[model samples]
Target: MAEELQTATDKLEDEHYPAYTMGRAAEMLGTTPGFLRSLDEVKLLVPQRSRGGHRRYSRYQLRLATRVRALVDEGTGLEAACRIVILEDQLEEARRINAEHSSHQPER
Candidate 1:
């Protein structure tokens, strides 16, 4: 029982674990599988395939999908939304790296 609980707990926080099947992911995102397929077509978030040839999504991918869904709900074209999300992500990573580098620098 404890082991089962531990496994569930780990899955709750494992960002890269391919835990969600296509139907489940789509349901959770309040969208359809075709929508996810469209995102895949644009190379926005590629899901991992299970050994039995099912598409599996991780938490990270779900987050991206959620962002895309939000943008699409706001009337953004899928391709443009993908580009915007990618740019936002890149900008965020740059800010993080800059902050880390600034913190590591010694005062002159």
Candidate 2:
């Protein structure tokens, strides 16, 4: 029982865990549910759905949403903002991969 509880707590701590409902996620980001739906409509951050078919978001996805929202607030179009965020995420992932590769390479 204790192990199960610990595992559940670990899941909550994971950034990829879909821990927040759409409404709660919007409230946390100070945005409206409509905005989150727009993000979803654009395929920016397609959240996982709950057992009942409600959208559930992870912390990682929420951060991406926040970035897109910031760009939109600064006058960028929704599609453009999503593209920028996608590129940023790609760059970060590439950098992470490069760093791992560099670390694994033997020095001359």
Candidate 3:
């Protein structure tokens, strides 16, 4: 019983788990399914497809969609918003890697 509970908890915690349908993800992001489709079209946040061919969104993808929605709400074009969001994510990752590398360097 505890193991089953833990499995459920882990699924909730996993950002990469495809636990949300496209419609749910769109609703969570306060956007439309068409908007989510545009993100997939731009290859910015391609959601996984279920066995029945329905799109399944991970938490990570929803977050990306939220960011893009914010930009789009600010009057940015969809394609440009996707590009900005992708660049921002890449920049954040690069910064994290640089910080980790710097922290591990020996005093010089």
Candidate 4:
């Protein structure tokens, strides 16, 4: 009974999680599997891996891939484009966090 309950719980968790396999992620992002793997190899987009060694991509990764595609469409090389995109994304995220933090602070 306990084992069955645990299995059910695990299934529920999996269903609620935003996890995607490599092939599914590629399809969602409108890219080839090889291209996704190359992005990972280049450290442009790293996905979470399961204990069994399967790749799991999140929604964040799919968004990043879309950004990468846009940059490429703008005539940027893959490596350079990825670097620029990552830097810009980091800066934007930092600014957003800072803005949220400052909004919560007591105004002078």
Clashing pairs in 4: none
TM-score of each: 0.85, 0.96, 0.89, 0.76
Q: Which stretches of candidate 3 lie over 4 Å from their true place?
A: 1-5
lDDT tens digits by residue: candidate 3, 1-108 = 999999999999999999999889888888789988988888997788999999999988888888988988999998899989989999999999999999999998
Tens-digit lDDT string for candidate 4 (9-108): 7755663344888989888878889878878999987787889888787777777888888888799999987898899889999999999999999978
Candidate 2: regions farther than 4 A off: none
RMSD of 1: 2.4
Please write out the lDDT profile of model 2 over residues 1-108, one tens digit for every residue.
999999999998999999999999999999999999999999988899888999999999999999999999999999999999999999999999999999999999
Pick the winner on lDDT between candidates 2 and 4: 2
lDDT of 1 by residue, 1-108 (tens): 999999999988899898999999999999999999998899998899999999999988898889988998999999999998889888998999999999999999
Assess candidate 4 and give its TM-score to the true structure: 0.76
TM-score of 2: 0.96
Top of the candidates by TM-score = 2
What value does the lDDT take at residue 64 in candidate 1? 86
Clash totals, every prediction: 0, 0, 0, 0
Of the pair 2 and 3, which is ahead by TM-score? 2
Model 1, runs deviating above 4 Å: 1-12
Candidate 2 scores a C-alpha RMSD against the true structure in Å of 0.8
